[model samples]
Target: MADSVGFIYTFFLTAAVIYVSAIVIIFGVKEQPIRSKEAKRVSYSRKDVLIHIFKQPLLVVTMLLTFITQVGNFSIQPLLALYIHDLHGPVNLAFYAGLAFSATGLGNLLFTRKWGDLGDRIGHDKVLLALLILSSILFIPQAMADSYVMLVIFRFLYGMALGGIIPCTTAYIRIKAPASMQGEVLGYNVSFRFLGNVVGPVIGGIVASHYGIPAVFYVTAGIFLFGALFLWAVRSHAKTNERSV
Candidate 1:
């Protein structure tokens, strides 16, 4: 009942925000005039978009990293209740698990915009590297935790570290993609994110049921580390390409 109420309230709130944003975009702000027919044309067909994306090596790396990170992040969320129950034998495991999942949203709400601003001030690669490393380190405590309190602490830390990843990834994409193809590129990125959402829980459930709850954290850490290494390699490749150019 409480969960249902919360979901309804959240839905209304999100709808209201979207409604306001649309209103603002439509009336509260000035709009730019449409481009004339004589303006340069950019191909946005599916095949052309895919070809454009494949041409940019950095975008491919960013998509892969985002996919892996998102999978690792979301995979553990659904299993947290079971893990918490096993760890602390709580009377209200569902409530505590909801709290655990809420921690990630809280972290994102508090830090996502701030991280984006920071990425703009610093560089996306630096911010991405820091967040990835910190998130990976936070997983250690989560994997080793034996109590609900400890699990909550580790989860919160993990959430805070992860708060920066999406913003940085988006910022990197913006810098890498041409203005004309931004939407197409972002569409591809969103597809990868959705793929992660689909795969994460299935993998998490399998690992948690067969092996153990801690396996979730260990697997998350491993995936995150793989993303970090891949990002580092991509950064190196970018520098090499720049030098060659």
Candidate 2:
């Protein structure tokens, strides 16, 4: 599309779309008032916000999970083209890599809402567990992929799993935190995600350089498992604390 339309033109077109979106948001969307902890003060100091974030075990763990999840995602994506080559994919495997990337996005588009709905029906925690575990398992097959098509399929499935995570965490925060704290807590969550984005590719590149590209997938899967285990333990501990009290 960029080639057909000209890259420079596409860039401007995309900027225009974003500007229009921003205009719509500013003009069209009505934001509710913030009350209580947030509105009473100018802003929570960095230290105070950090303290509050750490005090909530569930939120802390969820933020950590978000970070780890992105680590896995970023780790694999930056080297997807190389993985396709190793799989003896099609001659246009470079293009196939892009396709593989888009596959995950398509899956996200198709299934994100379904995952959110499922989370609503069951529980966000369980939904989180399912997504993480399924994501972990999906990585193994991706590592073992014999063709680009197979890898693309796995990426799509993994994306489906990924889509629900943000929604679940957002919903969880809304239910668990005061409105004032919710915004800041979610801010920290996004910060964690950005941190993971920074770290994941470096880790992935290092693992690939030392162990081979397939090893990166195995390691990515392990990262996802670590998130699942961490969240599970936190949930268990919280439950135990509730029972004892």
Candidate 3:
């Protein structure tokens, strides 16, 4: 699309798609609040919402992971086309670049629900940990890809791993946070992710300019690795505390 009509038009087309999706959500997705038999009301203040999230180890850690995940994920965006051209040379670049980018979304589409099911059966923390580590490992291979095909393949796998993170994080919050506060807490989680989205490209641009495009992948991998380790330590400490109690 960008090749045929320019990126400005391509962006407009993308915006149209987003509008359609939003319309569908607005029209088709209805939420009727479940009423308890007693119908009692609990007033959860905004300040309490902030304090509650901080007190919950899982919520705080998952929010951090969400931020880290977005940072690592978007860090590749500014550099991907350049990397593709450097590795594959500059012929028919648009088609190859589109496929390389789309492959990750395709993987996410096919495997996210499966990962969610697996998380339901096992545990979201364990699932999130596995995905973080897998995502970390996947980024390194992209740095070392020998061909366009290899980069696309690794990205698809990385996308599949990435798919699990959101569901697992959302499920963790949903299961643990009170129903009255779930929406606000999730909103906070999203704010962290959006902040990461803003910061990610800047970091990628700076690192690629200074250290070259491949170095961005290494930095992305480190971010995911740090997230995995952080989640693991929190999960372990929580379990040990449970035992002591």
List TM-score per model, in order.
Answer: 0.83, 0.86, 0.93
> In model 1, where is the ten-residue run with the lowest total lDDT?
34-43
Off by over 4 Å in 2: 2-16, 27-49, 88-94
RMSD in Å for all candidates: 3.8, 2.9, 1.8
> Cα RMSD for candidate 1?
3.8
- The better candidate by lDDT, 2 or 3, is 3
The clash tally of candidate 3 reads 0
The digit string of per-residue lDDT tens for model 2 on 126-193 reads 99988999999988998888876788788898888888987888788777666656677788788889
Q: Put down candidate 1 lDDT per residue, 1-245, tens digits, no spaces.
A: 23556657867888899999998889888867537442236556788778877787777888988889879887887887878788877676557777888777787788888888899999988899889888888887888987778877777777788889998988899887766777678888988998999999999999989998788888888888888888888889889999999
Q: Candidate 3's residue-wise lDDT over 2-118, tens digit each?
A: 788988999999999999999999999999875743223675889999899888787899999999999998998877988999878898788778888899999899999999999
lDDT (0 to 1) per candidate: 0.82, 0.85, 0.91
Worst window of 10 by summed lDDT in candidate 2: 34-43
Model 3, C-alpha of 170: deviation from truth (Å): 0.7
Per-candidate total of colliding backbone pairs? 0, 0, 0
* Pairs that clash in candidate 2: none
